[model samples]
Target: MGIRSVLSKPLAKWVVERQREWMYRPAEAQQRWMQRLIKGGQNTVFGRDHRLTDVRTVEEFRQAVPVRDYEDLKPYIEQILNGDSDVLWKGKPLYLAKTSGTTSGTKYIPITRDSIPNHIDSARDALLNYIHETGNGAFLDGKLIFLSGSPELDQKAGIHVGRLSGIANHHVPGYLRTNQLPSYETNVIDDWETKLERIIDETIDQPMSLISGIPPWVQMYFDRIQERTGKKIKDVFPDFSVFVYGGVNFEPYRAKLFDSIGKRIDSIETYPASEGFIAFQDSQTEEGLLMLLDSGIFFEFIAADEYFSDNPRRLTIDEVELNKNYAVIINNNAGLWGYSIGDTVKFVSRDPYRLLVTGRIKHFISAFGEHVIGEEVEKALTDAMSKHPETEVVEFTVAPMVSPAEGLPYHEWLVEFATPPHNPAQFARDVDTRLTQLNVYYDDLITGSILQPLRLTSLPRGAFQQYMKSLGKLGGQNKVPRLSNDRKIADGLMGVVSGK
Candidate 1:
């Protein structure tokens, strides 16, 4: 074995042991971090304005600061952008993570010096945890490719500004730099198609062992590889054992991805955002991700059902219950106060606070009071596909068709199929049945005849990709929403179909 492979076991063991110190003591670690954040904020403008210095408990902190989205916090962000120090955090932000915003256009999230480790180390810890559990560190000796945004960055107001993936490129540890694939020149290409082609050319001949990206984009890479070499990914890169992915749930794409690889390998799911690295899969046997309690972010939850209600109860870590969906609110060391990143999660195990990302607060279908979520739609489709083993899905989205040319309005499933189902009508009915079982409100609406049974629209290949390209969000952290209450996406898909 190589020196790095031999040493990985001991290093992973040490990291796992240190992690246990904070992982098991959830309440204590959260309380301590909350106090530290409060103390750090006391000297900043945001802290003084919100009376944070006098806050001694989580309750006081909550009372002092209201939960705010990007729009609500823009004034403070504007001040920071104009070269002001101590406006939000204690000092100027180390970097600004630029991400796409639905209503706000582009959002610049502060990455303070104190908060960078949370983003960097959590990813490292996730890999180490996998090694410690499986005793398979040989992948460390081979090439690893992270299919992400360009590493090149621009400066705004003296702070480096770029996508989170790009900013993270500057912090990759020295030890693994040699094994990381795609030369810097290839990484800086702005056009995703060009970048993808370059990446395939660079890595196809290498002894690749690990690959990481959002599922759809990674699927595209795999597809291109097969097209070029007429071989499955496993044949081209036999040592490719670990697949690390994040940004979206992998269930819907799992069957197709595995089929593309032609074998089953270890995969890690991560819950990361521009705001923070919240959770990661710690155990191969576990169903949910282990939430990071001491990652410089103090978390609060509001029940998903009550999220739209006035005076929603924001509960701390100790107050959360298992299997109940709650919108996540975070107060982190990066100067974000009571920030809502729009994700909802459900705890599966409270012993170590492992949770599943249920859905986004705004990404849902409640057109007829049938409030269907991402989790429900994904699970419904997954269950239905289980029976149709020959069918393979490429991409899909759900939107309400309130005013169809014929019949009662219904939920429309726009799917791009790699292999069409043998009985498409039966497949749609199966999916509808599963969805109705998962969501009582949806079931009621269907039974009462308020809405017709859901309809399936088989989209032509690359239809969703064309829609994303039309919106100038073709790649790099952009994902199709699982479902939307409005028909914007449905109409857009129609446009793409007609244009084709």
Candidate 2:
């Protein structure tokens, strides 16, 4: 046998064992999973969405549930302001998880006992697989760093993504975690500078064995760690064993972050969202084994290729077809049924149920894995530039690229501005400051060594006008692609940004 196959034979067996264990769970077998999620998700099920307590039968719960966006539940959210419990599901909501969603902008995703287990169980299964794969779980038992959000919401009506964030951290067993941002009890705005100052100050003296969070932000922390502590983040945590990451592609961030740290750390991939915790890597090498959370959710897989089709095929966890890129649709015990949360994943294996995140099936950019979509970027860019008035940006596109040389490729700005900033470097700084406030992920990517320096490429005004002329795409539904990994798609955007 070839050398590679010989090495992989044992791995293949383990992969099979793990996958088989997770996938074949029938509806009846998922009783415990359902109960845990139902109990934990008290807020999501019984509270905001109103699907839980009313749903005694699985089918009634499934059908009566209308798929909802953050806006759909906004009025109900306003009622939860005075620490009201009647409007929300059982008990006072344990807390809010601040997270970013498609249309809701940044929202405070409500989490209750009913909702938290979905995240906890999925995270645990994924962690379990990672431990078996790397055998580094022992070291992880030490001080583990999870680089998530501040987990607080401005007590406003709009959905704050950070709320979901705080709720996740709060629910995690304190014994396994290290320092996190502004506490669940606090009402910090999640301002990038404020949050970093707190995290940096808090963690400066401590040592960590494992670190996990969005790739972009972690890269930023590496720099902040160096600036404040004088020692490279790598030296500070010499025995850093695991690098658990989710949200964005690590390929772009890997070289610089590790090479600069001048060490090797096992990287673990994770898949969680505002909707629920999805899947994660089983091993550093193996494609992520999707640990099906049988209890928390009943999954429906829609064909990724045929996603928007008139008759797209959907397969449930029990009926998922093998080897297909399926857009995930979930029937969360918390009451989300066939809800399309806008992610596209390809199935690597079905017997045990594992999936690979291909590209964004949504209009999102994970440049830092904070899951910012086209709207957020467009809005933030607009809001930031509004004051300058020196440059009236006509059109723009933002994307993350892997460098041809090394490290995460720098973000290139294709902006069409009226009176463009004469100095490229200074303009880049202004843009960076604005984006950081909008999404910590983008801010961190720019600050970290993992990504290249930001550059501005001003385009002419007539550019976007002319391109739209040729493509025959007269703007019926011409949504911009926020995270363009494909070079060709990125190149095409230059015309609009540059007015070429």
Candidate 3:
């Protein structure tokens, strides 16, 4: 380990030790602020009539913040866009983080200056937890590859958050900014493809230790490395320590990432968004993710079993149930009083607030916890397909069947062709193998004969994207959604994938 690597643990210890200062200090002070924030959230987010603000104890924080769906936050989002600063954070949000939603349209979430440290802290917790879990303290010394929105700003506000990929160009630390794709405090990605290519080329030669970012783009760069170098990524950047991915599931494609790479490393889940970096994995060996920034943002949990119920109880951080899935609610500094990012997560513990991200409430397969997530399925499918000759896939989506056939509960896939030999049957077998290899539950269900076999289909060029574009969607914040809870989505995908 290098000098920095050896000091990685020390640096993390310093940060966590200082969390009290950045967040809250003194037990009484912490308790006082907690109560105040809870009351503030209940009255401001839940509405003035909510009885939650008056309730004491940590349970109040849980019960007051109802598990909200994304659609419920449109008006609040509009408030942020129009320059109203009355919601979550304390100061003027440094800049907005662009992202996409269930559909193709964009979502512009705010990131206040105070919240940036929280992101760093949450990320640091993840890094430190890895060190503790794997006994690899020098994990950060290796080249850290962050595949994020390009360093090109969309140049307009309210254009939706995903389009704001360029914002990171300015928000990133100054030391790294100079080595960045474009110069400081400036939004410039000279040529989208060329810039991405340059990033891949530059990153390929480095000692990439810890990789972090959105999984899709991570897979994109991995494919590029293989195509340009005529070898699997293991041959190029073999020293990868751990993959730190949030904003998506890593289960579907764990085969391609964990097993496909040359090194054996950990995969840490994070609960970061354009909105805020809320939670992270705290322990290296623990099954659930640790939440470091609970103080950065007030949290709430609603039992999945109670989602549609009239008296569904939304509990606070301390009242969260272990191992069972629940929808999350948040009141952060971004002016989103009580907002739900539409993600479904389950708490593993709360001593430090760790969680397991099950799936998106609206996006997951309700049938048999097929819980088909983007990161997992994406990595799985990509790894499976890469096993073939001279080929790599750019994108894919999985849609579950609405109508079951004779004890079969299959999920149909829509794959975008990257090369020839696109035989649907072979691809199906490949994908099925991936499901069994990477996803434990998927393998169990398949072995137990619970679900139907997976089906594969290729879409015509510009079919689903065109549909998105036609709807005035299609941007960074929004990806072409692959899985759906809505039954109608299957027919739409079937028609698009078949080019019918």
TM-score (all chains, Cα) for each model: 0.99, 0.59, 0.71
Tell me which of candidates 1 and 2 scores higher on lDDT.
1
List where candidate 3 sits over 4 angstroms from the true fold.
1-3, 16-33, 36-72, 84-91, 103-105, 132-142, 154-169, 174-195, 258-260, 350-352, 365-396, 400-482, 485-500
Looking at candidate 1, what is the lDDT of residue 389?
A: 87
What Cα-based lDDT does every candidate model obtain? 0.92, 0.57, 0.60
lDDT of 1 by residue, 290-364 (tens): 999999999999999998898999999999999999999998999998999999999999888999998899999
Candidate 3: residue 20 Cα off by (Å): 11
lDDT of 2 by residue, 1-500 (tens): 33332434454456547555546765444545545444544554233355555555545544555444457666655666545554534554444555545457655545556667778866755666665555444554445656555544344333233445455665675545433333443324334545666666666666566677765457666767777767766778776777777875555345447754668877778777766788777656556545555546666666765776766665556666665556777655444444676776766775556776654556555554555544345555555455454544445566666564655576666665535655657667766666667667766766765566555667675454445544543221122344554455457656445555
Q: Please identify model 1 stretches exceeding 4 Å from their true place.
A: none
lDDT of 1: 0.92
Segments in model 2 whose C-alpha atoms lie over 4 Å from true places: 1-22, 26-96, 106-108, 138-141, 152-162, 177-189, 227-232, 318-323, 364-481, 484-500
Model 1 misses residue 352 by how many Å?
A: 0.9
What's the lDDT for residue 462 in model 1? 89
Model 1, backbone clash pairs (residues 3+ apart or across chains), number: 0
Name the lDDT value of residue 493 in candidate 1: 85
Candidate 2 vs candidate 3: the TM-score winner is 3
Which candidate would rank higher by TM-score, 1 or 2? 1
